[model samples]
Target: MAGIWAISCKPCELACVRQEVHARDAEAQLVRLASSDNVLSLIEADAGVLAGMLCSTSDLADDEAVSLIERVAKLVTCPLIVMCDRLDPGLIARLFYAGATEVVAGGSSSSCEPVSSKEACAKGALRQATSAGAVAHSKEPAKSASGMDAYAEPARQVHDRTAFHYASSMTTALDEPDGLDEPDELGRSDELEEPDEIDGLDEVASRKAMGGRSTSSEPGAPVICAIAGRGGVGTSSVVGLMAATAARMGLRTAVIDLDLMHGNLPALMGIDDPVDLARLLKDSDSVSETAIEATAMMVSPGLTLWGSLERPELAESMGTAVEQLIFALRDPADVIFIDTSVAWGDAVAAAVAMCDRCLVVGAPGPTQPESAARIAQLAARLGVARTKMVSVLNRCTASSLNEEFALRFEMALSLHSRVRIPDGGSEVSGLLSFGRLEDLARGESRLTSAIQTCTSSLLKELGCAVPEGFGKPSEQDSGGLRIRLPWDKAGEPR
Candidate 1:
């Protein structure tokens, strides 16, 4: 008996596909391919016995999925249906470009629907692929113009219920008389041409502009967690400044507001309406790189901000979601900065433990140093080493009391690195309140110089190669008016 082959690394997704196939046609056997190697071997061994193949994008990256489809299409004579978790037009277009006979959504348990509903959608898509015989038996697969149309009608019957049908309108521009050009070895065309009338061209353009997904061979970027010993110590300000500084220095930076409750990064960055991360976390399993890209708001040229929760009450339950978000950001960013709340909740603990360095922000006072000590103890318990913890004395003044607080904070944490930011008075607060961080970062002031110096020191310690002339005075300050402070050396205290 002919069988239907399915490829998915996720067990739940594979199970759904299997159940759906069995429900639709009990006589049709279901074969699950665990990896790409298995897929090619199965096609080579018995391509004729397979009725169709179901490929799920839930487990694979976008580029990986497109490459797999292109390779299988070149050899297999059966129908290929791509199972997507969401309805992303760019991804669907690419799947069809790579020779998918049909594209359907909600094949994984990550969908908003329950498992039963997901299974029903999978059943409809499978039934259409096998019954319609979406592809012709000719040696070369039928061109997109005709092949896509053949399966489109049957797909529409269940369109509202489960599947999405792409007719000639979606692929008319792709059907050149010369036929589809072979994609390069990396599954990219030498010259990528977009259809003039694609539905989601704007989204596709944005994804491309954002550099798509990271295919870097290097390990993921380091994560830096900024936590304050107490409220009003300017931890969020420090994090925002550092992120903005990094982006200005030609690094792709991502800032995550791990504070969750009462996160103010969006406000500080001047984003009036931020993405609702709480809702995205509600379906953590559905969170993908694509989902993250959609949720992230590009604040500047090289800076992306993943806003915090709109509803503060949802903070406690979002620990797992925070972890998922960090994992998803590993690829696309050169470095990640996390602004954590003063409260040591599950979210804060997770960020501290996973960070490469913990920046403890404190202010000059008797009580704040003690609070810094407590923060140090908690960080130690959370697996952060003393050497990896950097201390910052914010709102510093030229007084013995400020020096005393700085000494106490360093001695308590046993930290080798310490930074000090002179009080910017009300001006800095005004800038932050109005979301004018860019102006504050670029302004020629003692506070701006201190923050820029601190940012440079942190980046160097993180092992990132600093660009030429980084942290130098801007053209406006080129009149030899730059002042050097005693704490210019990042790791040493005055």
Candidate 2:
């Protein structure tokens, strides 16, 4: 069971690869690479299959592509599949000559092919590699390049639909500390890699993040925080979609509105006079799971909601209470999402500080990237590791300016991975504005599918199992390329 490891600094590309890999073989374990450093580490540690997707024309040059292929090929024995965006015959030849086991050329502007075509190309490459006896030569069948087990114990015992069931069960087991036996002196955990930090914090910060609670040692849901430097970037909308989607997948999910001043989740969710998170925070000294649960408005089965204060008077005191609320929700929800306010302040910082993972939503604009960079710096100062943060390009349209903004964000924020959310047209906007999010979640629009893709990527990063029936999201034209958000030129209304 030598699994496949997909290496890419781009979130969208790696996501495409995961979809192709899973569709081709559900039992296969997919590992992601965030940087060239991770690539070096993976090459040194494990002998497994590898897949790499080149950047779009705007982000990557031909020489850089050659250099990357050469460096990776020189060090590893695994089979390699490379997908090029332009599909130039010369570039394809150069890639194969540089050590790529198979070169794929379908993402070109001329092809206008869907991601399914790219998936098929990758699948063909993998099949050729397997037929050529690539997996037979691996050092260990069950180990991946990261030294983590490629598949769980149940993976070997199931097939087809039952296979995903086993995988989901495996994810549940991994999320629970009690489900695992004690590790040896190395502080290791079974199944997954040992956690280097608690919520991306060092030893001292991990202890402080717990606020004197022992919850860090317990098995809990992953807390995800979504933030945008300013408003109209779809931060709250993204948060709602993710929460609803996770709930539909059978995970108990909770959405905490940290936007104390002007929270829109209550309105967007169509909940009239929802429970204010401030009420739960006022009794922070005696806050318990029961109290938190009592205040939560049930959006659907497995999904719970909590909104911010209706007015801004108590905004100042809600900082510490945000941390307390997150701590209490750890036991009940499989994933807790904090929809932080658009502004940077104590509340936003507290939410970022407490999250296991953070999604920075930036629309295409000079100011958005700058604000995103500032948020990244703030997170770094608060001890949140850069690896735990991902930039999400929301409301994206096709434009070179959008690409520039995304590139600036990547460079300024030092972020390796990014997910793109396409601009859903007026119809999608109408649904969001009128509190018809469930329609988008169950609908087939590009926005709906993109959110699903984003959710899958996050779940994979957290070692959770993606639910069944998640078909591949629709790909963009010109190799899945997208540029700007819908409201970048004009201020988008909430």
lDDT of each: 0.59, 0.55
Q: Against the hidden reference, what TM-scores do the models get?
A: 0.52, 0.57
Tens digits of lDDT, candidate 1, 1-494: 55565555467776555543443334666777888778888887877667667778887889999898877776664557666776555565566545565554545555422112123222321111111111111122122112221112221110111111112111332244432222221112222233332212221222121111122334445678888778888888889988888877767778998888888999999898998777656453444334455567778777788868878888887764565566456544667899988876666665665565678888766688788888876664333444456788887763544556667777776565677777777888899989998778888787787777778767765555556667764564334234667775675756
Model 1, residue 16: what's the lDDT? 56
What is the alpha-carbon lDDT of model 1 when measured against the actual structure?
A: 0.59
In model 1, what is the error at residue 140, expressed in angstroms? 47
Q: For candidate 2, lDDT tens digit of each residue in 1-494?
A: 64565545355455544543443345656666665556667766753444322222223577777667666665554445555675354554455445444433323232422222123222322111110111111122221111111112111111132112212323443355442222221122231132432222232122222231213344345678887777877888899988877766666677888888888887777777677666756453544444455567766666677777866888877654565566556554566788987665665665665555679888777587788888765655453444457788887763534666667766666564578888777877788788777667777777778888789767655545566556356556325656666665568742
| Highest-TM-score candidate | 2
Misplaced by over 4 Å in model 1 are 1-217, 282-286, 398-401, 472-494
